[model samples]
Every structure is written in C-alpha cells, then in structure tokens.
Target: MDLDPRTGNWRGIHSAPRDGSLIWVMDPNCGAFVMRWDDEETNPMFSDATGMWVASDGSMTWCEDTDAGPTWWKPCAQ
Candidate 1:
C-alpha cells in the first residue's frame, strides 16, 4: 500500500486479501501506515466493526457513524 503524505490517502498496488486477517507495515518505501481487518479478535479495538487503527508511525484513526455509514475514518484524539 502507498500512503499519500499530502492527503493521508492510500492505495494498494495489489488487491487486499479476502481472509479476515490484518496486515501492518512500517517501511518508508511502502509508506509508514498500513492496516487490514481481522475478524477473530474479541477486543473492540481489534474488531473489524469498531477497531482503532494505528499506523506504524503511532498515528491512529477510527470509524465514525454517519448517514453514509460507519466507514468514515476520523483521526484519533491526541
């Protein structure tokens, strides 16, 4: 995945896996942030529904409720 430093947007070079597992990377060449879902975890912070996403750089973000849905990504509080 590649993260745009200017927009905080990302795109994956390859399609993400279908399995319910999470992936994270900290390499500069691949950008400093990466996250995927894992369904087996019981913690809300790890749940695909209400998980807290933390980048390798220590930045965090999470989903928020909206008319569109719970897919809106909001920056975590410092």
Candidate 2:
C-alpha cells in the first residue's frame, strides 16, 4: 500500500476523495481500505452498528463498530 499524495493517507486500488474531511486507511489485519473522519469528534452520531459517515462531497463510507469505538473502515466500492 502507498500513501495518497493528496491526503498522506493509505490509498487503495479504488480511488476516493481525500480532501482533509475524510481519509482512507488500510486495515492492518485485512489489508482492506476503510474510510474515517479526519476529526472523529465532529461526528456526534458515532456508535456501534452505525459507523457510516459522509464526506463533504456526499461520498459515504463505513467503519467497523466496536466497543473501542469505530475502528476499521470499509470504503464504499466504486
């Protein structure tokens, strides 16, 4: 995996936006690309089984829901 030049986050084969509001992250355990909010605190509705987040451009992504909070994110397929 390589860091996205635009956002400095991991990039996957499928391309997505990295405009600073959200970023792509690679799951160390599965090697899958997930999306996470650049600032988790801004997300007031974060919770288990409901980790879906939308970017400024209306692009949506999901993250794993866990007791530790939203963990691994799975980017929506293009």
Candidate 3:
C-alpha cells in the first residue's frame, strides 16, 4: 500500500493495469486518494472532495453509495 498524496496517509494502493494505465485503491475512510502514478508523484484522484472509484477519468462516477461520493467538483476551464 502507498500513501495518499492528498492526505499524506499510507492507506492507498496503486495497481498497474495491463493497458499500461493505473488503478488506484483508496482506503475505507475515503479521506485520501491515489491516481496514475508513474514518476515519484501520485496524483490525488479527487475532483473536489471525498469519493471512491477503482478508476478515474475526470468524470462523475458512482462506485458505491451516494453518501460517499464527491462533494465538490468544478468544470475545468476547458
């Protein structure tokens, strides 16, 4: 398990996929995040607030209950 970059807590994991991407496994507390880590930095897989997903692509997704979903998200200036 690796430390969540957002919370500095060692309660997350990063799995290398067969597609060469990444799958971040956060803890149960939903207080941290993990993203596709290639270099030394691990991108926090959070759009605005607490949430849970075995994957991430910058879209609103539901992995489990609604109460544990993201509480904040803003449209990127794209």
Candidate 4:
C-alpha cells in the first residue's frame, strides 16, 4: 500500500490479479473497513461498491447510494 500524503488517499495491490488498483479509507465513525476499486477493466459489477468488513469472520457487504439493496455476503466457510 502507498499513501499520498497530500490527499490522504491510498493505493494498494493484492496477490490476485483480479484485485487490482485498490483505493482505501477508514470509516471515521467506526475506524473499520472501507475500500474500493472502480476501474472498469479490473472489476465491473462492483465498480462503485463500498462496504464494511469483519476481519474475524471474513465477511463483507457492499452497496451504492442508488442501489435498492446491499450486496449479500456469503457466510464464512466452516
């Protein structure tokens, strides 16, 4: 991950190729998960999605401002 001090923004990469060019932020209220990847060539369906995550359980759900419903997260594997 790299931080741009001027904008207080971040960029990062993961092991998977599909996990391309990530943008990140911290939820001021909760101080938890908040990240996005909107590049069309990388991720299409979730282009503008944003979500919170539970590290302990590996769970997340994403929704957009205009979305009628939040995207569902699959339960953690046993």
Q: After aligning candidate 1 to the native by TM-score, how far in Å is the CA of 58 from where it should be?
A: 14
- On TM-score, the leading prediction is 2
Residue 14, candidate 1: alpha-carbon lDDT: 33
Clashes of 3: 0
Clashes of each: 0, 1, 0, 0
lDDT string, candidate 3, 1-78, tens digits: 323445433322322232324444344456433333222222255334333343345443333324563222211123
Looking at candidate 3, the ten consecutive residues that score lowest on lDDT are 69-78
| C-alpha lDDT of candidate 4 relative to the true structure | 0.31
**Candidate 1 per-residue C-alpha lDDT over 17-71 given as tens digits, one digit per residue, 9 for 90 to 100:** 4253344423233234344433332345535455333333435542322222222
Q: Mind giving the per-residue lDDT tens digits that candidate 4 earns over 1-78?
A: 223323534222222122332223333233323343233322245555443222332344323333332222222124
Overall local distance difference test of candidate 1:
0.34
lDDT of each: 0.34, 0.41, 0.35, 0.31
Indicate the TM-score of model 4.
Answer: 0.24
Give candidate 1 regions above 4 Å deviation.
5-9, 12-15, 20-36, 45-78
The better-scoring model by lDDT among 3 and 4 is 3
Model 2: per-residue Cα lDDT over 1-78, one tens digit each: 433334534444234443443454444544444444442423344543433434435454434443333333334445
Greater lDDT among 1 and 4 belongs to: 1
Report the alpha-carbon TM-score of model 1 versus the true structure: 0.24
